[model samples]
Target: MDTVRETTSAIKLLEQENIPYTLHSYPTENGPVAAVDVAAYFGYAPERLFKTLVTSDHKGGYYVFCLPAEKRMDLKKAASVVGVKNLQMLKPEIFEELTGYTHGGCSPFGLRTKLPIYVDHSANNWDAIYVSGGKVGYLVEVQPKVLENLVDAQYAEFTK
Candidate 1:
């Protein structure tokens, strides 16, 4: 099945930038599938699969954090790095409005409006990592530095 979002603008951005990525698809379900599930199903290392999380301040401003599947984001630490007093996961509606993509389909690659991106320091340690392909049950493999180089993502200590 084609789990990738057919109408996502992220795909076009990738094509325009000539960024190489491997598209992966698995069975889509209603519930959340952890990044480990993707790694196991695709025969890749769990450490190499990343999950994109949307977090925000009290205002409308938001940030995208790309981290490893097994590691939990340290919200407090992240907030400190971003120089905000508080931060929390963005609501689904807010996410849709900001990125023009559904919760499971959100990709840092293409957004309706460009927002600041923060990559967990750990991600840079790896040569390649797997991220969302703008849809549920789909993943894209790319070099870790691409987030910073291509997306202008900042490096931060987002993990506890």
Candidate 2:
């Protein structure tokens, strides 16, 4: 028997807005799958897949960042883009509680709270990009502009 996939909040939001997206799923035996591994499993170039990261400012304000799976976020640049003195990655322990999504499954869309989102400027190079589908084992392909509009994201040079 085939397992039925339940719609994630991210998917629901996209559907409600009439945005086009494609869902891709992969099997997992171990714990949370890394974004790079997911991109490999789907036979996609690293630049075609992006990952969502949550960070907090010194004052405890939260922000979300989306960047290519192959790149590391430049904390200093990210802080500047977010208009904070400094920013740090949120603790893994509070990831799910704060974002309502698991560590490897966070999406900029449909977060537990409305937070400022930043997407790496490089994403503009692609007509479409894949991001987590608000769950492990799945990804959603969408146009960058639609995603940015839906999440009120700003594009910036935040990746190193």
Candidate 3:
């Protein structure tokens, strides 16, 4: 369905930016939906569906990474990409307070705080990609260029 499951700051920001997008809502009755399942529902390769991951540098600074849902983040590469000696996933409990979004529901847009966002370079292989609609069970599909432009995200190779 093209209907948004709900309006979020992320969606609002897209509307404000005039970026074209489509919304897809997946069933969440079974709790958080796996990224693969979401991709399968739309008959897309996992690489086309990116998941937002949050990390913290040893120095307490936070960063966001977006990679294919099925791929793994190489800590060394991730740390280097973010210019950190040590990179750790932010604890699930801290996601909401720190980013104004819950675990598995954070998007690169409309964050509570400004954070450097890095998206996997693989995203460019797709004409468009899906990201959390700022909430679980909802996704927004938009051109990767537009997504990167709107969020000021850097494209990098951080996947293993």
Candidate 4:
């Protein structure tokens, strides 16, 4: 397959590792689309899509969470899992500053820094998951284990 820079760093890494993947992009309207929308348009199950969320511990430490699209992350539980006393989401500008990606384009694949990555245990239940390709209207489908392995993420109870 032809490699493209539109993908996240993680996707690039997958390419470098010779992992097979397929990239998908669609019409975007500059807003968060329901996971069901992606599934409906892409012809995949909603359960097979993950969303990348950028959050922080009150101490100014930012981290990323890759969770199933159907579930929401429990901030309290995430803070406890990461051993942080307080957890909150960073401001939109802060996220752009830290991750070098816009709100809708954030992908856990490659970031400006190696932020702690937490993948919900539910992700392991799926063989392939579709994640953002560092831009709105773009996504990449890859093996779930490959994503976790590339990011060196910890498996945790990240969803509500």
Best by TM-score: 3
Model 4, 1-160: lDDT tens digits are: 2344455665666678887878877777753477667777777777788888989876778878888777888999999988988788778868877987788777877787789988888777877788887777778888888766777888889678
TM-score of candidate 2 on Cα atoms, chains taken together: 0.93
How much is the lDDT of residue 160 in candidate 2?
A: 89
User: Candidates ranked by lDDT, best first?
Assistant: 2, 3, 1, 4
Query: What's the lDDT for all of these models?
Result: 0.80, 0.87, 0.87, 0.79
Q: Which ten residues in a row have the lowest lDDT in candidate 4?
A: 1-10
lDDT of 2 at 159: 88
Query: Poorest 10 consecutive residues of model 1 by lDDT?
Result: 1-10
Model 3 C-alpha lDDT per residue in residues 46-144, reported as the tens digit of each score: 999999999998788999999998999998999999887989999877789988888878989888888999999999999989998898888889899
Which one wins by lDDT: 1 or 2? 2
> Looking at model 3, how many pairs of residues clash?
0
Candidates in order, TM-scores: namely: 0.89, 0.93, 0.94, 0.88
Give the Å error, residue 140, model 2: 0.2
lDDT of 1 at 133: 80
Candidate 4 regions exceeding 4 Å error are 1-10, 30-32
Ranking by TM-score: 3, 2, 1, 4
